[model samples]
Target: MNFLGFFNITTVALALMFIGSIGMLVVKKPIDKVILYSIVDAGFLLAVVTFKYLDVAFAIAILGPVSTIIFLMSILKIDRIRHNNREGGPNV
Candidate 1:
């Protein structure tokens, strides 16, 4: 509504995005990145709700992490398989 309100929205959105990117890029651990990404998605959902985009927010809430979890699961599984090899690697 007001300039300050819009500025607040922008600042929040930017901060969330920046935090997400930092987590995704700077963190060496995959689990931490996934958690941060979920946080970022929740932040986005909050932003959308603030703008009265309830439908979009709901869609994001329902669908945002499905693929991410699937991918993470796959990666973990692959890591497990590799570690389970007979070469005496560390197990997951």
Candidate 2:
């Protein structure tokens, strides 16, 4: 099945990973990093699926978003703390 004209799922997954990695390296902002991270994460999940590891793919689908949320929450908390410090507010 020449879906998207690709040889196989592995090729598609690898291409995704390569593009995401390059984007991650090039992006400067933290939010952009997160977006790139999601791309890389999706690539990894696709790779898992390609290997016929449905269980692993299910786990990744469940945990990947959780990890991304953790990263986003941390970024928000850090930014808030920095803003507070800059405004002479309490550092709590």
Candidate 3:
């Protein structure tokens, strides 16, 4: 591609990453965090795709869902721990 095309794609990828960072900082919920992470991952993948690195893009895309799932699981675990702490002791 031409220089202009390359510049445009890079600009878009940067914008996506910036927006994802903002979302990650501003949002407090687990679901929102997951979404923001997905956006960031997408931005990275877009950058790779723009540079014609299809193998890297495919690898990143495949890993995205697993990362998201792990994030969700951690969030749930934290919430459960907090809840248990608040409840004082185990039930009879």
Q: Against the true structure, what is each candidate's TM-score?
A: 0.66, 0.81, 0.82
Please give the RMSD to the true structure for each candidate, in Å: 4.6, 2.4, 4.1
Cα lDDT for residue 26, candidate 1:
84
Checking candidate 2 for backbone clashes, the offending pairs are none
Q: Which portions of model 2 miss their true places by more than 4 Å?
A: 1-7
Higher-scoring candidate on TM-score, 1 or 3: 3
Per-residue CA lDDT of model 2 for 1-92, tens digit only, reads 65676567898789889999999899888899899999899999999999999999999999999999999999899889999999999977
Pairwise TM-score winner, candidates 1 and 2 = 2
Q: What is the full ranking by TM-score, best candidate first?
A: 3, 2, 1
Please give the lDDT score at residue 72 for candidate 3: 90
What's the true lDDT of residue 83 in model 2? 95
Deviation of model 2 at 48, angstroms: 0.4
For candidate 3, the 10 contiguous residues with the lowest summed lDDT are: 83-92
Query: Model 2 residue 23 lDDT?
Result: 95
Write out the backbone clash pairs for model 3. Answer: none
What is the C-alpha lDDT profile of model 3 across 1-92, one tens digit per residue?
57776568788898889999999999988788888888888888898999999998898889888988888998888888878778985522
